[model samples]
Target: MEVFEKINYLISEKNLSKKEFADKFLSLNPRLRTTGEAPSYSSIYGYLSGRREIKIELIPYIAEALNVKEQELFNFDLEYSTEFNIRYSKDAREIIELLQYAPKNMIEHIKATLQKFKKSYEDGVKEPTSS
Candidate 1:
């Protein structure tokens, strides 16, 4: 899968229309475009339709705007492909290293905690509990 395919998959998985996704992205990163706001519809359409490629320098901002890790922007296969030579940031690299050492049970526990935390936070609760 290429970057465009991955992005399309993510967009569909999230059940977001292009305009809604763009709006949410802008909400996350108000400084994404030179206008200090989200990209216009045409810009998004151009990128998604392959008329314009997503620039390397804008990858971080796009990932942040989408509330995803920068590495997630690339297709998983691309990450393993010899042709793809992107470098991870120090923090992201450390996280990848840590994941290698993490136990399955630990990863599951963290996932559960994160789910609970997200729910609680969205509900404006104080904290999440195991139960």
Candidate 2:
């Protein structure tokens, strides 16, 4: 999906209306217009509708409005996500490379071990308590 589509999906996922999204975006004061003011509500609607391109400068404000990281807007596909992780995370890259050479049985055993680790970590997590 395109960036606008991703934004729309995130808005719906967050249970926000277009108006609410526009309100939040405006409240962030993106200030991308030539006049150094936040874009008008109709302009925000245009961005949502793909009638206008989302300015690069507004990405942070848009992300803040949506309560998401800026990369979340662009990371629409698994290929991009995997490439990003592999580029930035040595451990992730090594794990993927190692998995490629692992036998099926070994992979299954690894999965089980990872699942146990995850469960143990989750079990150890304590919920925050009110003072």
Candidate 3:
């Protein structure tokens, strides 16, 4: 996906309006907040509206502000076409990588555990309060 498209996706996923996203992005980043080149009101509008190119250097700041990886803004496909996209958090990505090397039996065990967790959450099973 294009940079703007990814930005839009994040904006929607995080339940933030365009202006709010821009405000938060500007406020959270100290370096960019002070610099004139920061993604200010006008610049953010330009980026989202496809009137300006979001500079490559700004990708990291954008990702950090949104709590995502910088690669998500780029159009590169990490794996082949048949694979699921790696759009997960850093911890999830690490788990995915670790699972790739896990034994088949261990993978099955993990899957079963995950399924149980999913079912539990889906069924509204709350955790016990800690003593």
Top candidate by TM-score: 2
Per-residue lDDT of 24-104 in model 2, one digit per residue for the tens? Answer: 888876786567878988888999999999888999999999987898788765433633442343355358768989999
What are the per-residue Cα lDDT tens digits for candidate 1 across 73-99? 774653444543434333444576698
Model 1 is weakest, by summed lDDT over 10 consecutive residues, at 83-92
TM-score of 2: 0.60
- What is residue 74's positional error in candidate 2, in angstroms? 0.3
Global lDDT of model 1: 0.65
How far residue 7's Cα lies from its native spot in candidate 2, in Å, is 0.2
TM-scores for all candidates?
Answer: 0.49, 0.60, 0.55
Worst 10-residue lDDT window for candidate 3 reads: 75-84
State each candidate's clash count. 0, 0, 0
Model 1 pairs whose backbones collide? none
Each candidate's root-mean-square deviation in Å? 13.6, 12.3, 9.1
Error of 2 at 49 (Å): 0.5
Pairs in steric clash, model 3? none
Error of 3 at 81 (Å): 8.4
Q: Mind giving the per-residue lDDT tens digits that candidate 3 earns over 4-118?
A: 8768767776778988878777876634434645566888889887789877666777787777777666633442123433454334546976887899999998888877766
- Regions of model 1 farther than 4 Å from truth: 28-38, 78-131
Give Cα-based local distance difference scores for all models.
0.65, 0.78, 0.69
